[model samples]
Target chain A: MKTKGSILTHKPSRRQVLAYGGATMLSTPFISRAWAAPVEINMLAWYGHGEPDIVSEFEAANNVKFKPKYYAGGDNMLGLIAQSPPGTYDVILSDGEFVQQLNAAGYIEELNAADYPFDDMLYGDFQKFPGHWKDGKLYSMMVRFGHLGVSYNKNAISAEEAMSYSCFWKPEVKGKVGHFDWHLPSLGMMSLYDGNGAGLWDLSGSQWKKVQATTLSLRPQVGGYFDYGGTFNSLKNGEMQAMCGIGDWITGVLEKDGAPVGSVVPKEGGIQWTESYCIGKGSEKAEIVKKFIQYMLSPAGQVKSAKMAAYPGFAITKSGRAKLIEVDRKEAKRTGQIDGMANDPITLVKEGRIHYRNIPVQQSLEDWNDFWSEYKNA
Target chain B: MPVSGKRTQSALVETTPKRLLSHLLTFKNAVRLPIIIWQALFFIAPLMFMVAMSFFIVRNYRMTEAFEMKNWLKMMGRDYFWDSYGLTIGLATLATLVVMTVAFPAAYTLAFKVSENTRRWAVFLLIIPFFTSYLVRIFSWYVILAESGVINAMLGYIGLGPYIMLNTKFGTIVGYMTLTLPLVIILQTLSLANIDRSLVEAAHNLGCRPWRTVFRIVLPLARTGLIIAAVFCFILSFGDFVSPYYLGGSKPPTLPILIVDTVKSGQQWPRAAVVAVVMMVTLFIVAFGGIAAAYRRRVR
Candidate 1:
């Protein structure tokens, strides 16, 4: 144009037009980046009574957004993780066996100890990687752990009768016993009843064969095998004479409902499972993730989580254990088992009664699948 | 030849190709081409992938690259798989029969007997249950059937004592019926409404008894709707995860529930996929066959 504005208003030559288009294309991404915002962290957790509140607190405390996905069971969460792209979740909460599998698959990143400010606050035993973690690089930190035991209808069975695994296998309870549908814990109890004890893990050849035989023997007597919530309902309604069940459901929901149910830590110790928090290997916000983990391990998080009937993963934090004992005392007093609440992890492990430690993947799968198939068919 | 006639012939030949090209590039047809391509790409491709994956082995939780017959072989051999399949098919069939029996009369009453104003409210009532969460509806059945629940509580008042129905196959079947009954009645009602009243009058005028008139005329005409309703009930009952899961005791896990457990345990993806694929194929065959049969009868 005669002036600069007039010149710009004129129709551009082909070369000039091409140059302007190239400039716009080159600058568009930069302009978009300038407006880009913080990435939202998505989380998936099991359906726990207190988990929703915990997630909300985490979101508010960090000034970060969280979208929580709930699942009916831990396996559902693991299945989701198995299918999703790595780092699709910034954080995941999983049970002990699943955490081990994730670590082995390299789907989880090793947490740098330095990033967690509250590591020293944890107890020595809790800090020791529970076989899933190795060396100094932690793969997962225990968020909660609980015992698996049997719950029986007190009106149907005596407290002393319910204290042993043999009670579930008794011929009298045929078509009346309820077992956890899961293999490891159910078969683990069977192995204990087979006189294997913690040595079940060390069994091979004919010794393992004996344990398998023991499971088959009990199969006929077993009325049903149930998952977590369903087991409690069955026990409460007296549909099952006795059930191999989790302590949480027995102590928390059933007892709270005033159901005449009693639980036991079998002479052969029951299985203990821990739920843990771990960062995915490909998470972009590793620092923030570590901060989140540290916060969960803090005393406040431990106590809040404990009140919901889950044992805090950190052994040094006595809050959860203390709360559990108090609740247990109340339950025992009501049920007239004054000393029943005395059973704890340390005592169980010290008594050489624990069945298996750090169950290997291959053996757990083989044993669980074989036992489940037999149990279902029987 | 005259110059003008020769020129006109050359011009006509030149324009023919261009006119054909313009016709081929019509806006409407061009737009429709992408939609057809997209349907094939997005809709048809995933189904093909699932069908192909069903034939392959999955190792280490990943579907293997090579084709294998292990999944199919394992499915055929496993008693657990067959038992669940048999249970699913039997339960589905029984539920379908029950639904048809109940829905026909209810639908007829709504279609012919009810006032138009009441008919709307009746249809509204039939569809209202669907607005609630499916899980909530199924769980409500537990309250009705539980040992200490409503049914047993009522029985107890009459000195019959509490009865256990909450964790049995019967309980699951009843729950499945409740979940499917509404859909069956609503669909059959729509079908009944479309029937020409003249046909029923003609059958009656021809000296047909009331029951005979209904059985011979109304039912035959409503065959398409009945088939559709059966298919809906069967599929819903067969694939039901919640009803069987919540209500069926551990003694007999449904096919969907079993697939869930297998996948969750993380030891048997290949097996789970096989179960899923079998369910899908069974559903597909039943649905298509039923539709085809209905179509044939309709055309005749």
Candidate 2:
């Protein structure tokens, strides 16, 4: 009689052959790893962090690939690094204020200030910027910079009225205001509006309470919190009369689309915004990151970055500035914000009117978020 | 030395182990082993790790070897933690109830009262929304429900003026209802279809009315399906982060969003893990208790 061993010895089953085939298919990726794709560098950044064509060309020239990721806020960036293993990121496009936080966690690599052309490559005091420097070593390079103020529809509110911070809580403008979702700068704007001399970064306990109360008070009339695209959509659709913390990027892009949006620096003051490029600590492709940064600091990169998706570049470098055909000076004058020609980062830092953002301690940041949540709960 | 004879004896002994291996790799076991491995690796392992992490305290953004009950202790003291937890459960239950109530009738119509062509078209329409991305769908609703969006614009046409709907609890509920409807309907339809038509005819022959037949005979048979559908709906709504984040507009926050807010600090993941454990435990207790009570009634 036929038995199991005799049958097995006679022929291998089709099922067995298929199982081995499936295993081989599953292992193909690992087996092919020795002949991997081109060199790839991952970048964590904000919206429109790079020009598509330029990025592609840079990849082609260096025989590498671009892997870009975006984050909404500085704290959000820190949160990503916190959750990931060390060396997961090769570079990050982050806010300058977060340099301290990055340095504290040893997330960013320290750079030699002498390696690059700082004087012509950066604006006044932007070269060896105090906020971005520690122990006489530069940790990051500032690329995009602006002030956090208000953006309003010209049809809904007068330009002069929008210039005053009180317009946010005024009865006539009630229920027409919107806020960006980022708490740090938005909270800073609130402090300035409330005339808190304690400043935005280090608020006194009483000022903190006052700020909380003000946020709560505004909640009833405030429309909703929004991101960059959401804020623009609301403005275009007439869903919001005004939004907080809109810069040239917000209004300039909308204006170019033929939407009548205007940005204003209120009477009290506005918080300054800065974006920096940081080399991640323990990056595997250190040389690629260096080359990318070097190319980005050049006029070719600066010009490309400024016009990256309607976020017009007001380049810091003299060479970068030479590439701009139009500064939109007339619109800047009308809006009462920064003009491309005259504004310098150093003067803004020296002036007490502008608040310098600080990297938040964990507990304090959590407290701030909780306070915002409470205000929303109201 | 007569080593050839000795080799044959040893080979015969080794064949015994080969027979065991062959028994283990039979067709049924071969297929099932992959599923067992997958569930163990993906589901059970992470859950175990999370539960283990919750028992430890997070310091300076990293977990320490030191054990602490402080996270558990602190969770009890926070009122919002409890509030967020309750809201998540309540909203999920609310959404599930609404879905079941609405979907059961629709499913009944589709399964019992419709022509084949009609059923096909209806199912197609139900599935059409899934063709688009969920985020896109949610954002589309954001536009339609805005203060100046389509709904208000319609109301404006009738001189009703504008009514705010976009960033409220009502908006969030509506979003969840819309998102979870298709899943609930499809599940209940499958359940309803499997119910023997003979039961309905028996009830009718016994002079039972349509409503009575449905309530007493058909639904009783479809009880398992109803439970499955409701459970799926509850989990989806309870763990939902998008609708509440975009439409809830800061009010009526849910537990998942709270978990995210807590974990967004990066160092506070252990704290978030504690919240997750509590949520899982509470849901498990409620679900199992309901099932047990149902089983007791059947036994009686």
Q: Clashes in each model (backbone N, CA, C under 3 Å)? A: 1, 1
Model 1 C-alpha lDDT per residue in residues A67-122, reported as the tens digit of each score: 66665444456567767788888777777666767777677888766655334432
Pairs clashing within candidate 1: A1-A7
The 10-residue segment with the lowest total lDDT in model 1 chain A: A332-341
The reply for model 2, stretches above 4 Å from the true place, is A1-38, A50-54, A82-87, A121-123, A172-176, A227-229, A284-288, A310-313, A325-351, A360-363, B1-36, B63-66, B198-209, B289-300
Candidate 2 CA-lDDT value: 0.74
The TM-scores of all predictions, comma-separated, are: 0.79, 0.81
Which pairs clash in model 2? A306-A313
User: lDDT of each structure?
Assistant: 0.70, 0.74
List residue ranges in candidate 1 displaced over 4 A: A1-45, A49-61, A69-79, A112-129, A135-137, A169-181, A201-227, A235-241, A309-341, A356-367, A370-374, B1-43, B56-59, B267-270, B297-300
Question: Which candidate gets the maximum DockQ versus the true structure?
Answer: 1
* Residue-level error in angstroms, candidate 2, position A90: 3.2
lDDT of 2 at B77: 73
DockQ of 2: 0.22
Interface RMSD (one decimal) of model 2: 2.7
